[model samples]
Target: MDTANTMIRYVSPINPASFPSLSILLLAIGIFFMSWFIVYEVTSNRFTRNLKKELLVSFFASLFLGFGVLFLVLWVGLYV
Candidate 1:
């Protein structure tokens, strides 16, 4: 019973101001993994080579795309 109480008490709520950074980090990481997975799966085609290049491209693409959308939303939120 005491152990269960301590486990439940260990959780804490997140701060609202911290949300933007946390959200961006999580979104970017998720996008990176998802893009990598897609690229890997598509590479199964016999005609396709250069797996490293494909993975690198996907990584940077997702990174930029995630940050781009994040800034876009922040900019829009400022005006509206």
Candidate 2:
């Protein structure tokens, strides 16, 4: 049992505006990268003929990453 390793770590409360800023930053980055990936996929591969499917996959991937980061921030409390 590592008692020393477990404790309430917090320097301050999360600002109300920080959440929206994080969301916006996350979305902007997601869109930026998704655009590049979609363009690259379509241009590099001839088999990927369906734009809808490419978009769907990219959207899901962005969502998954965003949600994953959100969950981690919520559960772990980013900032110690």
Candidate 3:
């Protein structure tokens, strides 16, 4: 009976959505960048003349937003 108890304890639960694919990450990144780029493009054209001239900076910002949103969404989706 002790062996059965240990075996049961050792057993692990499998969840299908536990591991999301790289594609999801990529999609999330795309969403973030696009969102930033869209807003930036509009504002730059509307107000500024030089338009900030910072693709790399925008890219990083997009990446941050993208990853953060992705993580939050994934976490909530999985748990809630």
Model 3, which residues run further than 4 Å from truth?
1-20, 46-54, 57-80
Candidate 1 C-alpha lDDT tens digits along 1-80: 66766674443355446546765775677677667767677766756657686677667767766765655465445521
User: Best to worst by lDDT, what's the order?
Assistant: 2, 1, 3
For model 3, state the Cα shift of residue 52 in Å. Answer: 6.3
Candidate 1 vs candidate 3: the lDDT winner is: 1
Q: Cα RMSD for candidate 1?
A: 9.8
Which ten-residue region of model 3 has the weakest summed lDDT? 10-19
lDDT of 2 by residue, 1-80 (tens): 98668976765465644765665666666667677676768586677467777777678668856854674475455732
State residue 72's C-alpha deviation in candidate 1, in Å. 12
After best superposition, candidate 3 residue 40: deviation in angstroms?
Answer: 0.5
Per-residue lDDT of model 3, residues 25-71, tens digit only: 65567676677676767676544634355576477666766655555
TM-score of 2: 0.43
- Comparing 1 with 3 on TM-score, the higher-scoring candidate is 1
Highest TM-score, which number?
2
- CA lDDT of each candidate? 0.63, 0.65, 0.58
lDDT leader: 2
Worst 10-residue lDDT window, candidate 2: 71-80
